[model samples]
Target: MWKFSIRRILIMIPQIILLSILIFMMAKMMPGDALSGLIDPNIDPATIEERREALGLNDPWHIQYADWVGGAITGDLGQSFRFKMDVTDIVGQRIVNTFWLSLATLIFTYLIAIPLGITSGRYNDSWLDQSITGYTYLGFATPLFIFALVMLWIFGFHFGWFPTSGSVSPGLEPGTVDYVISKIYHLILPALSLALITTVNTVQYLRSEIIDTKQKDFIITARSKGASESRVYNSHILRNSLLPIAAFFGFEITGLIGGTIFVEQIFGYPGMGQLFLESIMIRDYTVVTAVVLLFGIASILGALLSDIILSLVDPRIRIK
Candidate 1:
């Protein structure tokens, strides 16, 4: 297992390097340099050239990429052109916000998906399963942005049950209980928006897996042995059915990070997603490239984690 993990990590090095080269070239292909955001089109040519030189944008693409990669190894992601601040610092702050939002969404996802899926699968062709299927169809059909808007209106604007946007209420003292309550309140709608779709998707996958697993020879053998139906389902069926679900958990987390962008934007939440959108609008190459690289690295790490988890859950996977 350890050897497998080490091998995977070794493989990731080249994948990440190739990813960086692709992203760097894509960023270079974009219409303007970082300084374009800061300088007016009417600015004197010599002035722009000097500014570009000062910022080292005058260097060749390979040189700049090498410098960026070297700095990244030292935990420096470079400064954002738009924010005029360290990329690490800016992204770090947003990561905390995104973490909380994603955490809440994840909790909601599993809490809802597990029971709903199990029940729906166990009761296949029954009214209960039919109802769950119908509900999930709605979740699958609704676009995320549309869902966000409907939620913002129903909960935030109309009912006043939850705050529509932002991480917390303005002027609340940060450490107090009230502040915590307010933060959670603000999070409810956006988190629900993200979690609803994920839950529905998870439920569908789990339901399918459960149905398949329940038909396996082992499940039939357990039934024939006169094990109680509940024990057969719970002790054997659920455990085996959840293996594939467990394997995908890491990838789901990375997907949540990417999904958070749209949710955060709609909710006016200050997270990496919002930062990424703003950075793109401003053509902040350093920030854009950094975020893209972050996403790529995260994806590779997620895949690695998923493989490890699969091996742990089913030792047969480790042998393979």
Candidate 2:
């Protein structure tokens, strides 16, 4: 296991290096430099040159990129060209906000989706199955922004149970219970928006796998041995059915890391996705590169975890 982990990490090093090169080039290829944001149309040339030099804009591209990449290795993400603060600080705050939001979404989606899918698949052709299928279809079919808007209208405007947008209430003191509650209050809408969309699609994937697993020859054999349907399902089918869902779980983690951009934007949450959008709009290359690296690391690690999980849940996978 340790060997596999080390190997995976080593493999990802090149990918990240390549990713940096591409992101840096893409950013450079944009309309202008980071100074474009700060420059005035009537700004004097001398002052502008000073600003460019201050930003190392006049440095050779390779030298600048080398410094950036070198700093990243030392845990310094460089200064945000737009914000003029440590990129590490900005990313840290957004990461904390995103962590909770993503955590809530992952919990809600898996908790509801997995059991609902297994139960429905276990009772295929039943009303429960039909109902679940219909709901999943609706969720997967809807566009994320539209779904978020509708949910905001229903939950925020109509019901008034959950806050419509933002990550927390304004002016709440940090570390207080009130602060925590306010945070939760704001998290509900965006988390729910992401969860509702993911759960439906994930459930369908799990359900199909389960239904197929239950029809295998081993299942028929188990039934012939006078095992109860529940016994066969619990011991054999469920284990095999998990093979496919385990794969989906890998992508789920990636999606959780950065897929909810629309919902995050809609809610005005300061998660990575939201930060990523802000970066893209102004073509903030350094920030965008860092965000991509962050997401890339997370996804690769998640895939490694999912592989371990797959090995555990299915003996066939382990043997191979």
Candidate 3:
């Protein structure tokens, strides 16, 4: 397993390098560089040039990229031309906010998915099964942002139940309790929006796997032994069915990060997505590169973790 893990790490090297290069090139090629955000209409050209030189923006692309990569390695991450602070520092503050949103979405997806998946699995052609299947399809078809809008219209504009936007109600003080509660409140719309896209996808996959398992020789034998249907499912099917889903846990997390790019806007949630967009608009290449790198690291780490967890749960598929 250790040998396999080392191999995996080695394989990841090129991927990381490729992403680094891609991020560098894209950041550079985007219309207007960092200085575009800083230049004032009334500023003298020489002063602008001097400011550009001061920020090392006058350097050739290769020189700039080399310096950027070096700073990234040392955790310095350079300064955001837009925010005028260390890019890492800016992202660090936002990481907690993003983490909260992502975590809530993850927990909620599973909480609803697991039970519905199990139920759908247990009753193959029953009314309950068909109803769940239809519901899941509805979720799958709806775009997440559109779903968020629908939710906003129903629960926010019409009913006036929850706060429509932002992480919390205005003027609320921040702290551990308030912080957590604020997140929970803000998490609802985006979570549902994102979860809607996934619940059907996940539950349907799980249901199909479960139904397949029901036909297995072992399951039949267990049923012949007069085991209750629920017993057969709990003792035999759920864990095995969950294994495949478990393998994609990391990917799901990464997907949530990607999805946040749009969902964050509809909800006005503070997270990496909003940060990335704002940085891109200002051509804050340093900040853009930092967040993208962080996201890449997160995805690779998630894949690595899913592998480890899957191996632990199912002995048949060793990491080696």
Candidate 4:
């Protein structure tokens, strides 16, 4: 297992390099340079050109890419043109916010999905199963942004039940119990929105897996061995059924990140997703490339995590 993990990490080195190169080149293809955001209407063209030269934006793409990569290797992600701070510092703050939000979303996703999936599978074609199926369909069909807006409107605006934007309420002293409560309170709407949308796939996949696994010969054999229904279902059917869900976990990470962008924007949440969108709009190449590269690394890591989880959940499967 350790050898397999090491090999996967080694493979990730080239994958990350390729991903970084692709992100850099794509950022270069944007219509304007990072200085576009800094350029003032009254500023002299020569002054702008001098600023470009100072920032090394005047260099060839390969040179710029090389410089950026070299800097990134040493943990310097360059300065954000708009924020006027190190990109690492900026991303560090936002990634923390995103992490909490993503964590909440993941928890909510499984909490909602697993039980419904199990029930639906256990009672296939019954009223309860049909109800869950309809719910999942609705969740899958609704656009995340629209759901966020509606939630913001009804729960945040109309009812004033939850904060509409930001990770925490303003003026709360950090480190206090109230501050922690405010953080969780502010997270509920957006996290729930993403969870509702994201769980559609998980519920459907798990439900199908469970249903399929129930018909397997092992489940029948377990039943014939005089095992209790609960034992047979839990030990034989549900355990094996989870294999596909384990595999799906990696893809779920990417999906959550993608959904986060729209949800964060809608909620005005301070996270990488919101930052990525804002950076692109202003052509903050430093932040854009950094965020994209981080996202790429996250995707690769998530896949690795899924593989480890898959192996752990089913002892029959070996990494080697």
Largest TM-score belongs to which candidate? Answer: 1
Clashes of each: 0, 0, 0, 0
In model 4, residue pairs whose N, Cα or C atoms come closer than 3 Å (at least 3 residues apart or on different chains), thus clashing, are none
- Residues 261-293 of candidate 2 have per-residue lDDT tens digits of 777888778888999999988777668878887
RMSD of each: 1.7, 2.4, 2.3, 2.0
Q: Model 3: how far is 292 from its true place, Å? A: 2.0
Off by over 4 Å in 2: 39-41, 315-320
lDDT of each: 0.88, 0.81, 0.81, 0.88
Model 1 clash count equals 0
Q: Judged by lDDT relative to the true structure, which candidate is superior, 3 or 4?
A: 4
| Residues 1-320, model 1: lDDT tens digits | 88887887888899999999999899889999767777787988999899989988999999988987898889898778678789999989888888899889988899899999999999999999999999899999988888888988998899988877789899999899999998888887899889988788889999999999999999999999999999998899999888888888887887787678899999999988898898898788889888888878878888888888888887777623
After superposition, which runs of candidate 4 have C-alpha atoms over 4 Å from their true positions? 39-44, 315-320
Q: Give the TM-score of candidate 4.
A: 0.93
Give candidate 1 regions above 4 Å deviation: 318-320
TM-score of 3: 0.90
Error of 4 at 263 (Å): 0.7
**On a 0 to 100 scale, what is the lDDT of residue 126 in model 4?**
98
Q: What is the lDDT of residue 20 in candidate 1?
A: 92
**Is 1 or 2 the stronger prediction by TM-score?**
1
Candidate 1: residue 98 lDDT (0-100): 83
At residue 278, give the lDDT of candidate 1.
Answer: 89
Q: How many pairs of residues collide in model 3?
A: 0
